[model samples]
Target: MTSAAAVPTSLLRPAVNTAHAARVSVLAPTNKAHLGNLEHLFRNRGAVESTATAAAAPVQPVRRRRQAPLLRLPSFLKRARGDVAAIATQEEQVYLSPRLFQPVPPDGPSPRGDIAAAWQRLHGADGWRGLLDPLHPDLRREIVRYGEFVDAAYGAFLARPDAAPGDADAVRVPLHDPAYRVTAPLFATSSVGLPSLLALAAPCAAQRTSLVGYVAVCENQDEVRRMGRRDIVIALRGTCTVLEWAENVRAGLVPATEAADAAPSTGDASAPKVECGFWNLYKTAGDGSPSLSEMVVSEVRMLLKKYEGEEVSITVTGHSLGAALAVLIADELAGDGGAPTPVAVFSFGGPRVGNRAFAERVEARGARVLRVVNAHDVVPHLPPRPGGRWYADVGRELRLDSRASPYLRPDADAGCCHDLEAYIHLVDGFLSSHCPFRANAKRSILRLLKNQGANVKQLYISKAVDMRVRLDAVDMPGSPLGRLGTPPSTVLECVH
Candidate 1:
């Protein structure tokens, strides 16, 4: 836990509501279409036209006043309006035309041709120079897969909120790609002083410690051969409790070395600094348990030792708050010279974690970070740099626009914009910034939206489209589970 002496009272106080302001900006239109429409509607509100007299008096020639020069819309607004119109037209067609029920593509492993050869580039070694613009198909698949791992963490926590960490059956959902096996569950305790709503909601919240994520390993030899390395994954879910949300609001910067288990510092002003709240959450421990940092470092070290003398890579993934933690974990893991491996982070809708120097420190350790952001999501722009506190984004960014997807409403709320499921959905259908959402995106839109508690009544999903393809448990070459004949049926409603 952070020492009281280290954090000043001013830093602990809640800052201005910049997050809300950013959210309002995100929801506001970037074009003048709404204003123009209103103007046109009320142009002659109080004036009554005499149609009969005007028709009768048409014989006389009338002098016309020169019209004022029309105001031109900005180029970006023109593009925004064009995209909105295109999406509207597409949705209209889907609603008016006969529904086409096509067989959904099987959810098998997407053919990532020689991922082993280009894994470094995919992992942002060269800052993903050419891979992000067109969005390399392999990278897209990997992003979605890691995103699913994060989703699985959410499912686990929701299913058994009080379940002890490291429970073998903690994760209830089977990943689309059954290449990885859960090794251990990860947990974190809040060090914030604020009163928590979680204490009233669940018994586990009283402890200030809850399961956050899990560590998995690619144990399948086929997957290892295909990837050319044994991959270790650390997947974390976003904030779900009141205490976690409270911790997120503490944006004060503290030296990175303030962490209990952090390395000795050189005692200079140039040392890296991180968000005070995040550091406290990462370093704090429940009653008798180890801090999140200690648990993760210990688990990773053991895994590295077990996979010694083999090509190995570490991928840390999370959504929202989890994304921030993922960056922290990657930095810590990379700083430990004893375990030498390429460390990469795929963060979805994550906020800024630290200052510019902290980012430099992470890069100096050779850790690569790729932040996946929804252009409309406000969370990524959070913990505002008040008085120029030096908060900075730390990696290559892949920005996706929610407007590209025809299935979503144009007026999506802040929650919908920041939802992890929506982020994954956008990633699945994303082709490029210049391209529309892919027509053949195989993920069930209805399923994704429903999981996020979105209104799916307006969403049109054909009966066949609702079904997801799953590899039979026995069909998986090295799956530990016995044969599970068929996947469960998904009943979907098609409301016209």
Candidate 2:
């Protein structure tokens, strides 16, 4: 039997050569870093037109439990049966514009009234707090303490009991390729609250220079558990306590430079981490304002203690909704420290976030939030808005999906995708595009340009390319600051 791993990234392309890979120019690659970088700006701007409803702090009745995370393969495959069957029946994949910043219609015919009701059923998002809200006050407090614990333990771990591999500031980059020098940043993945995602990154966190993160697309705990197991079945081994989205895969090593001994500087903690796995339940566009606001605030607090004086490898990645969340989160982290650090945010179908205001925020933060979309999944395009018609000034939607050919035969693909890993990818690739991580890319790019020069204008990258600022637009000496920034889209401003 042909394993899915046999398929290379290029195999997913179609005969039309319209895949996102083709449109995304290397030099013109849309930067997905700044979307949430300006989250700090938003965080500070409590005065920015607060809505009257702001005072009505809505609450939910559902109970909040400590969500643990993963997926066991046999069961994982069995569970995603319905979704898999759905994908298999489709004949082909579909592609949409990659300009992710465009505004979604606040009021439009929803794909399903039930989904809208789902939003309202949970007290219009209040109920979700019990189900998936990682920002629970207790959780936030735990996260803060956890960050502190991680910081202290990590420092001691690097200090070592008897001997260490290298300097405390410098460590080996774990890699399959011996040729590679620095240790690769590991990814922890879980569909829901699988503990493996937490486990892999958790152990890595023991290293002061390591970065640990997770990606949650499946809002259900069962799904997360299943995903945790399947991930273990894929790359990692043994009994892991947590399953993170990027737990197994590691981005290229963070080159240990001569400044390994230098103390870390305090960048703005106001930037939030990528969106939490719990946000799959967040369906309303109106929630963006407050939800994102809270995320920024929580992340600032978490990071304040976690990264106060550390030289850890900053990694950014997530699946489905998480991937999108990572987009904005990466922006904030990158801007805090110097250098355009590479934090890979591999998203599966994410959704739109906000106007150019958010995109500029992403640009200021250094993030390359790479988004991946499966072609067969219709969820990516769901919560359908009017075609290029919206009430607010939104940015562009990035690529529809990099892998669209599979959607051409949705039935076949969806049928075989019964595993939690497969299901999470399907849900993310189809359903969630407003990944917090991806949402901020454009804003970060624009902010980078704007901060450098007021005359900064947004350069038009290809359609497949995200609408965020391209690195080529920056004025850095060694970098590709060749292109001049363009003003906001006057055309879109004139139109819907």
Candidate 3:
């Protein structure tokens, strides 16, 4: 009997195309009688049989080059079942670092309801002293939730520039992204409070209408409401336009105010010649002129006058551009001595809004400030915080480590890290272990991950490309592989 190894080398290793190899059907022993027919067909069709089947051929594992593990693989695939020896490898594979921020101790008690309720509970009679208490898990979670609302506020306000303060449903035309389906309103005006103040950018011919910021009036419950006490939350939307970027680039340092009696300058001229973007934003109106701060001051005065002789607590909250506005609004409201006293500001991803003198004025107002910063967010590092007091951040800071966030990776594009949704997602993860909502929260997060992936796959790239097509799709400069800043519809994707 001739050995199988004695077959001709050409016949043994047929010239089969790799593309067609996986598609070839297996032949059964019963079909051996038709070998002659099969050979005749192969000859006629210009096809070659691959004796070295893909399954039969030994595939040598490609050596993993010594480099940082770039992609975060699924947890299940990282380790072997019951294999203690793989622990070290698995540990090295994890993309997350230890928690960067510690849990703030609880205050006197946890607040209830939505962001409005939490605001009312935190900022009571004396001042923001209650709010400045190391954030209770309850307050933190609520603030994080409100962060999403603040994000939604931009879309909502932009959708209905003409929306009346009483028209809650009209204001919330309901965009699908970020997905805050807030139905019930604390009052018809403000969703979950008294009324809302929507501030549109100064009219620009380039853009028809733009919403720069808004104030949500969260009243303390009926007991406090009857007493006419209300907590004001001012949320500013971040830059969504090239026009806004132009404002950011106009970084010449200026006095916080035009008044000669303005707050004393910090007197540190050695610092960079950059001014706070927030001050320019505050001074400038939407029409590419100056008036936004004046509008905010007017609205605040109206609210204060409406609730005269009653205790009022105002807390300014915003992300990115809105965050800078939040701090400035707090300073404005507290400075007038007519709006309210002891204001508090919670700023997320806020750029350095003003010079040292500006920050001092905000601080002097007795406003309690908490600047919530996420690790890797490029916004906070802006207006550039170098040695001297050129542009400076004002307030206490709550730093969060987003390295383990599901929406991010160790090497995620830094711009995606600047997203407000990403910040909320990180905050939710921080509260998951300690809060009652953990069980439901985990399910929701998993669903979000799955849905987010599905949504991204529906995009043009995934629909058009096959496995054979390399995913070297262009990544814009200063952007991540999948997340592009332009064309707002782009999805976050990372292809290896």
Candidate 4:
């Protein structure tokens, strides 16, 4: 559980209504689209990914005008927003990052208190109407247009008997399936999935916990990719060849189906499902065994076997720590797991993964991995700037540095153009899931390119500086000197 201290009272402040003003004096359009938009600059051309949704016209960037205050929100939360001033530096230079939101109603008893419960009540299926941004004109239309998939995806899941009400939040199949849970998904995936798995791993900056996730995952893929000579299809009975499937996967052939088929299969009946990540907290082998990233990479090899030489859509998604885990799994697939399937990986609030060289390399190789974050959400800033001692990051590490807020100027370690909500608008643009990608079929295509699979657009993302509280000019929470320390009130923790 998050301790009250760790939770930060400031996070509980009023829904911030402040805006981070734009700093660029000359907002010039790119002649051919260089790495200008924080979203575009973050891309390493080689890391393009392919997606698996119905295609639409290629997205062209459009500028969004700053609008007036959308929702005033509760007063208590407002104080929190005012708190940013306590830490105000000599220059009051607030580092800025691109982030991207809308509105609602009135009525009986203003429901509130605690974000999670608040979301449940106001944004609940029945009361969600109370949360829209009244200032945004196309709000509901946006929801129906770009965001209908989330609802549809839910409906699709409901069609499956395994996707019962208890499974509503299961995330992936492995979390719900018991047959392979005990063995862990590792063993089943190793021989079958490692090839495709490593193919998906890319160079990373891995800032903060994302830094840890990247290091852990990158190292795992490095080992698996080194151990690449084996076949992908070693028979479960131990009689057939050990990983003959590797050759097939190398040639882009999918491996054979696993034993725990939706119907029936010939492989090991108890091999666990492969996808893995942090569920509240990520668990590792106490005896010093495989981590979730390792296990998932292993299962992916096996799972990809079924898709090898076959055309299939593979997408990986995670929120917070889970997003970090997703990166590792995707990386492993791209590098070592058998036969890379078209892949897309989406992570929310992820930290930087690598340096210019590594990011460039990933881009050159054609893989697409996108991240979404709110400007005030500071998890991505943890562990301090990479290359420093791990302890440098305790709160002091996060002190509103360039990496955390993006209010600072761009440097070698500065810029990242990961706005996904924009793309979501073209395909999945509306409905407004708090994570910023502009939802759509394009995002799926972008994911594929990152996985190194050839398919659609290859790569793209949403506009940063989303329509939420623009962290442009405002600094601390409240009062004269302005923007420092934890404010009793908050500004922009509002959610959809």
Which candidate ranks first by lDDT, i.e. highest? 1
Summarize candidate 2's per-residue lDDT along 1-496 as a digit string, tens digits. 1233333333223312324324332212122222222322222211111122424222211222334211111111111111111111111111111112221221222111121112121111122223111112221221122122222222232334222222323422222111112221222223223356654666543321112221111223332232221110001111122232332221111111222122222123232211222122121112112233233334444443543443223334343334444554555555556433233333444443322334446544534333333445443442233553211111222233323212112233332221123322222222123221122111112222322322222222221124222232234322233353333221110001
> What is candidate 1's lDDT per residue for 1-496, written digit by digit as tens?
1122343333223322346335433443222322222221122111111123212211121122355212221121111111111112332232211111111122334344456656766677677766776677677878987888898788778776765544535445434446688888888888854445755666555657778888899998988887768999999889987678888887777788745434323244366888777787788887777888988999999999998989889999999999999999999999988756999999999999988899999998989999999999999998776666568889889999887766566776687789887898888777676555554354544344344333222332222123222212223222212232234332221110
Runs of candidate 3 exceeding 4 Å displacement: 1-135, 157-205, 219-229, 259-277, 285-290, 431-443, 446-496
- Candidate 2, residue 436: Cα displacement in angstroms equals 32
TM-score per prediction, in order, is: 0.69, 0.26, 0.53, 0.27
lDDT of 2: 0.26
Give the winner by TM-score: 1
Write the residue-wise lDDT of candidate 3 on 118-187 in tens digits. Answer: 3343332233232332234444554564575566566665566544334544554232211122322111
Model 1: what TM-score? 0.69
lDDT values for all models? 0.65, 0.26, 0.45, 0.26
Q: Candidate 1, overall lDDT?
A: 0.65
What lDDT does candidate 3 reach at residue 50? 18
